[model samples]
Target: MANPNVKIWFFGGVNEIGGTKILIEDLGYDVCVFLDFGKSFSVEKQYYSYPNIPRSLDELIRINATPDASKMPVLQGLYTQSEITKLSQQKLLELEKSNQFKEEQESNIDAIVISHAHSDHYQYISLINRNIPIHISECGYNILKIRKWIERPSLTNNLFLLNVHTFKTGQSIHVGSLKIEPVHVDHSIPASYGFIIHTSGGTVVYTGDFRFHGHNPFLTYQFHDKILENEPIDVLLTEATHVTKSILSNEDEIGRKLQQAISATERLVIADFSDTDFDRFRSYYNTAKELGRSLVVTLRQSLILGALNICEGLATPNILKDETIKILIPKREDPTKPVTGERLSSWQKIYYQHLGAEVKGSVQSEDLWMPFKEMLAKMGTPPEEKLISHAQMLNKSREYVLCPSFNTIGDLQQVKPAAGSVYILSTSEPFDEEREIQFEKLLNWLELYGIPMLHVHVSGHVHP
Candidate 1:
């Protein structure tokens, strides 16, 4: 019953957990749309690691990290002018010689619809041509913009000036012979969505990494009910990540476990979880409130929480207004001096200023800094007491439920945990060797401090 006019191609996300790229082409209308243009961690890891990534889009195409434009001539025009120029210079493709390349590097692909803001789902879009519009949920777009603002600038993260189009749940987008309607779904990250795509051939339901056990299970149920209304789905592209082996716990259970673990410790309680998992952040915040302790988070995480407030319906704590939450400012080379000079990045200075820190002279007047500054202004100024220094943290180890990642775990060297302190690993176990090595290093750090480790987590995926 497959419609001959509609051809579906799966360039990635076939046998891997991430790197999802699905192309839907309507031959009759001469329209092509990609469901998600994401990075393939598995394929990229085969050739490169961190600080050793591909030099150019040509390199990625050569290693099969991204779709090969050489094999698919239609994709040549879909790439950015700079990438195409580099490829042509390297003799990878002769698209530059064509007269069409002179006409703004027009794209055959109608659109690239992102399911969420997770790196695996939308990271690769940076390499594509900006002419091809990108459609993402309003919340997802804000999250990505904030992430790009905070992270170190790179070619791979050229998202500051993207031609992005943000939509809300139930908003339908038209892309020539197709209608893509994004429906909200419950996932570890906020603004996750599933698509009900209407094609000339048939209806395709693409479930983009969903679960029915998260804080917003009702959203998943609503997605299912929406799919039910669109019966006779010719194609069902679902995520079966946890079908074989799944965790049997929910957010409420994880929260209760967090409370129990923190309550048992009279000294410092260090919690480690994914930075963007706002639900998990809520759990830690509530636990700290219940235990009469302040929830201390890194400055980066505090900025993310502030940006997430742009999305309505997401109930993350207002860090600027929340008295129980505090922003943890790690010590610079000069512990006594305020964070300034070359020590702080551009976004870091902006964030510190937003938190009432004396970093006014460090901030620049560049246009790139304006959006973030304007956003912080709208969020209002955080209390000066909300900023906690590493020295202060060391002095008050017993009064905080500190949340730090492996990257920031070195802070423990300064604020050495007391005898009764405990470290809770609230994230999933390492799935690859690289992360396993990092986890082992983290364990070594804790063991050196004589702090016992406890694993208390619930998988983001649902139990099949």
Candidate 2:
């Protein structure tokens, strides 16, 4: 009898809403690959809550974040040598006695193909051994790279740093005995992809988180046609995020709601959504333009857009060239007092460097610390006849759409939305108990400000 040609294993993202880790073994060729090594979104609730996380990676593994396969002998080759060594001290002693502990270490995992850049889908990627090669779309790679900058402490580290090799949509990638073809799928984030793997056992399809009702529904349909063309698929691993089937609004519906809310309001309009959701960004951006209002974003969002613009394929709003989009540069602070440029943190310096790098190659502290208006002037942006300062926004209350992230909510106090103003919650509702706590605080702030709220959002995940 012939030996089994392939073996499949599930490590995470099972019976849960993220942290999916699937291992496929090409036994015929003695190689294996992972579809996604994501961290669960509820990691804070399940294991470590904020301000109480373990100090070291060792502690992190003992509590949570460690895959169950760490102890299984069959998966010894799948994890990195360093990881295995940390998990098995007794085994390390045994290896030392055998005079094999000093042997060179390497990763057994052949490749890691990320579906998207969402934290639940790819955040835990930093946990994988850096030696293993990573494959993602060009846009996804650029997004991650941009995130690695501007963000304090950086998103990636040695344990899970990506040796990224980007591929275009529908490009075929060969890894040992298996062939992977990435199919572009429209999701909340740019560059989301589903995979069609050709295995010796049978053809397998894994639909990464995707939705057809987004701005680009054609891409999802294209994916459908491609998968159907494969004829007989032996296995299909699909994401059922909205399986319960709630009455959900598509992007178009959400846009209409936004338009009505903006038209009805007589004061400042502030819209809150995921910074990475380019579709929602576009929706608000277009609405702002139609209303002769500018879309105001913080430096981080502008940096994100700038990165997207530089990336080859992803469709992003032109924050730099477009007069309709204005930036609010964050001020360096010292105990609530604004500080001088010389006192900026390392990360802030990186932000200035990124902004300057976008304009040209030079990175001057003066250029870094310039006011948003001054920076725009340096970038050759026309003088802001309309969108300029917080005071200006206050004077012309209904002339702009302010996009503030949760962390930047304090800015709302400064802007002070007027009585008839509306706060459009264009993001997700808090479904988790822990997240509900945060949402409650946000509601408290809205109530205090007396701003009417409107929930106009579309889910990025398709219904079951």
Candidate 3:
């Protein structure tokens, strides 16, 4: 029988893709737990553009970029002290005028369970109160930690300070009277999971973004079998991302397609895909190896790979040890000088130092950046090696398969891809006006170099 005491609220992830925030309240136990407090790209784009973002937590809530704490007193104390202090006095007055103001107490929420590390699913976590423990998979936690180090510091990206608790698949987490069991599911990014919550009311299943058409379809199959074992579920929250789409492909097919495309090109081969999509990264890496071409990745991608390599059971290639893999360091302000710590960010300085390169500048104090310091310390000393410079990549264009994102596509101007060079768009097509504009810009860059572009992509979601 269904327990009437259990209630669910959909604060986001409805009628739009991403930005998933589901609140599961157990009235019988007098406790609440949130599932996946992620940002919605659609909602964010509605109000802000690049370089112009919400200045404070109050602004994010007011614009509906995140859940509105002012309207729901239950959410009143669920933000970090530093962030709440930044709320404008006018916003507080507005809350009081609407009879929605509540005294900020310790967080009432039991915990926030993250299903994955995708920005759409976990970006807003920085604004969450540190008192509220965040439960995530071990792989997801490591990915977020690395992202914090590489990304530029900002008000909305304080992920380093999160009070996190890591769990493995099948591990059960108890928050008040609720028991959450995270089960691994296949997705574009590693360490993705779905949750089966045993609440005071009933058993509810929430499927965070998942797909069965990737390298490990069996993982999603296992999740399905697990769901059947918990039959008579009172509620089921599942993703319907590709319900209307029919096109489908798998990792093996994509690998073969990539190899064929790379073999046909005699000159430079440029591949564009998500930085965190390790499955696609493997595909490109394997193709490069088979074709006797080095797989060149951006500094950010190299750092992500290095992070993944440290996590147990991921089997990621070590960039420092892999002879066929090369790190493409971006050009510094002084084009004449060799890459050094003085020209890099705090995290980049550490990475370059690890590569045995001469670092001239002082690193940032650990007092302000403990997480980056601690994470690097955990990684230990890697094999010292030299990074490939932009000039080196340009001269040896035919010897490498360059993987650059839209942000780094400008590098093509320096490489000036020789004739017969090809660009592969191994990612999804634009889903919105902003992305459409970016897509056009990418096309312009390829056209400028007279490089032929090919689309070879398999989605991270299953087809209907």
The global C-alpha lDDT for each of the candidates, from Candidate 1 onward, is: 0.78, 0.69, 0.78
Q: Who is ahead in TM-score, 1 or 3? A: 1
After superposition, which runs of candidate 3 have C-alpha atoms over 4 Å from their true positions? 83-104, 332-338, 366-385
RMSD of 3: 5.7
Error of 3 at 387 (Å): 0.9
User: On a 0 to 100 scale, what is the lDDT of residue 88 in model 3?
Assistant: 38
Model 2 CA deviation exceeding 4 Å by range: 1-3, 77-104, 154-161, 312-316, 331-339, 350-388
Most accurate candidate by lDDT? 3
In model 3, how large is the Cα lDDT of residue 2? Answer: 63
TM-score to true structure, per model = 0.92, 0.83, 0.91
Instruction: Please list the residue runs of candidate 1 whose C-alpha ends up more than 4 Å from where it truly belongs after superposition.
Output: 83-103, 333-337, 406-408
Candidate 1 Cα deviation (angstroms), residue 366: 3.3
Give the C-alpha lDDT of model 3.
Answer: 0.78
Which lDDT tens digits does candidate 1 get at residues 1-464?
38998888888888887899999887766779899988888888888877786777778888887887657855656678664323311121123223244326777788999998878889888788877889999888878878767765454665644568999885798897688889999988888999998888888899998888888999999999999999989999988777898677899998899888988877888888887788888888888888888988887777777677667865457878787788877665333456664767767777776676666355454444666688777666676588787667757777898887547466677667776789988888888887788789878988888899999887777668
Query: How well is each residue in 111-134 modelled by candidate 2, as lDDT tens digits?
Result: 889898877777666655555778
Q: How close is candidate 3 to the true structure, as a TM-score?
A: 0.91
Q: Could you give the candidate ranking by TM-score, starting with the highest?
A: 1, 3, 2
